[model samples]
Target: MAKREVRETSELRAIVDSCQTVRVGAVDEEGMFIVPMSFGYDWELDESGTPRLTLWLHSAGAGRKAAAFGANGNAGVDVAIEMDCEDGVITGPYACSYSFAYRSIMGTGRIYPIASGEDKVYGLTRIMEHMAPGAPQALGPGVLDRTAVWRIDVARFTGKQRQPKA
Candidate 1:
């Protein structure tokens, strides 16, 4: 596989931090499926002043991700950040479409399955906090009992953006 590419550093981290959900792309023997998923960021700096960002995602006992990893351990993913563009040039028979603002992060990495109970709970809590920051959060008593957290250890990620010029 070819090496991952990053157009800019600051732009990549900024978009990832601001965006809520990312479309995780994976392919299986059946076909390719792009899943819109949420993640938690573990942003820190390395000794050399490089930004280290990690995304945490979870799933129930058995889910599509499980099958995707089973099919290919070396699977990768692509995440996208889009804008809610209102009042666009209504073209064609459809209402409107906006491809003006977009930032996508794509890379190759191996998905690490969570085996520890603590890690699973932590991942789940992160998800809850992300979804409803102020709302009263309550996961059923048996959520962790049945849930399994799968963290995507993104080996390398880069951002591609399209924005208006000054």
Candidate 2:
């Protein structure tokens, strides 16, 4: 076993692209809250070569998620997200040696609502493109109004992998 510190931005992007779902975590009056749901993401390196990642998520306009993230409010709430692409099980002769192979990305950021109709459409389009490319991305009238679109501009992220032995 080796240390899990993935510093390469390309590798981190790959890990994110390989998965369709992300687990988002936040805290509210009740305590810690988390949910696993499908998502869409974008990643790029800025002019200074700093990595930038953005995630798009959608849910009902009102719920626990919205409450935890202050979706209906002006203030942004801190959140953590995680996604993983599982490879397979790594079998071993002994129990201690057994492990699963996977690549994962974990990040922290603030989540805010996409207030404008144009921005909501954009976020929904990205999600559709990532979840099912070539599918019709056009939104019907008032669809954006009924759905809650959220954006997460990942401040920092890291990737890790445990590859199976050859």
Candidate 3:
């Protein structure tokens, strides 16, 4: 079994879409911290029509994760993100021949808090759409104020996977 790199943008997006959570990693005065959170994603086209990926995350209004995201400042913090879907294991004649099948996307980006109320609503909407599609998509009063919404503009990302032998 061998690991293969998924180089196409569509393929990378597919991998991300298949995953439920994203692990965000950051560093603070104490040390490095990583947390897994529910996420939503979107893709935009640049001037050259290249696809750009942005991830949305939410949490309580106050916490270590919010601080690491530069909640109080306009400047954002650097973050590393990873998301994967386990595809199950493959059995072979011998232990050495077995391999796991999975697809993963890993990247680094800048995470910033969405300060505006409207933008926070937008982020929350995306998250709800992804996590609970077909459910009520309405936001009640004070929901935006109580929740912390974050936007991660992916600078660069790559996808990789190992497949079970046929």
Candidate 4:
């Protein structure tokens, strides 16, 4: 089983853009909790002209997930795309002969709840654009009041790929 690490930013963005949901892992006094959430993101230059990847996620105003965020902001996120299993290629009759092909990105980041109404709308717009391209872009103020939008400032991330042997 040979695995390859993807180092190019283009490849990483490709994997992220291809996925609809991100699996976020958070921990609190109780324990660890992982939730699959819809998200939107953008790669832009910061004030110092350094490239940055910022992710936007949203959830109900109150929940276990939100509680985890309130208690602790640090989290681990994973996005996977292009997954498939290859079977019937085994020369010998064994389960180990099968292989899976996939591309994934995983990393740790800090999740901060957006407090400003304008920022919330911006985040929600990005999320809607990614999740539903043709959907309405505007988010009502009342809707923003009920929803909690979060921003994940990715610190460091790595991408990996597993290709089925020919």
> Candidate 3: where is the Cα deviation over 4 Å?
1-3
Regions of model 4 farther than 4 Å from truth:
45-51, 72-93, 164-166
lDDT digits (tens) for residues 38-156 of candidate 2: 88877788998888999999998888887777643766888999999999999999999899999998889989988898888888988998999999988888888789989998998
Cα lDDT, model 3, residue 158: 83
lDDT of 3 at 82: 93
Compared with the true structure, what per-residue lDDT tens digits does model 4 show for residues 60-152?
979788877755433433322121122224243687766566777778777888879889988998899888999878666589889989888
Report the C-alpha lDDT of model 1 over 1-166, residue by residue, as the tens digit. Answer: 2233345567677767667776667666677777777776566778986766666777665766666754433343333222121222323445464234455566655555666788877776677676667776566787767766667666666666555433
lDDT, candidate 4, residue 28?
67
**Residue ranges of candidate 2 with Cα displaced over 4 Å:** none
Which candidate ranks first by TM-score, i.e. highest? 2
- Candidate 1: the clashing residue pairs are none
Write the candidate numbers in order of decreasing TM-score: 2, 3, 4, 1
Ranking, lDDT, top scorer first: 3, 2, 4, 1
Q: Write down the lDDT of every candidate, Cα atoms only.
A: 0.61, 0.86, 0.87, 0.73
Model 1: how far residue 27 lies from native, Å: 3.0
The window of 10 residues in a row where model 3 has the poorest summed lDDT is 1-10
Better of 1 and 2 by TM-score: 2
Top of the candidates by lDDT: 3
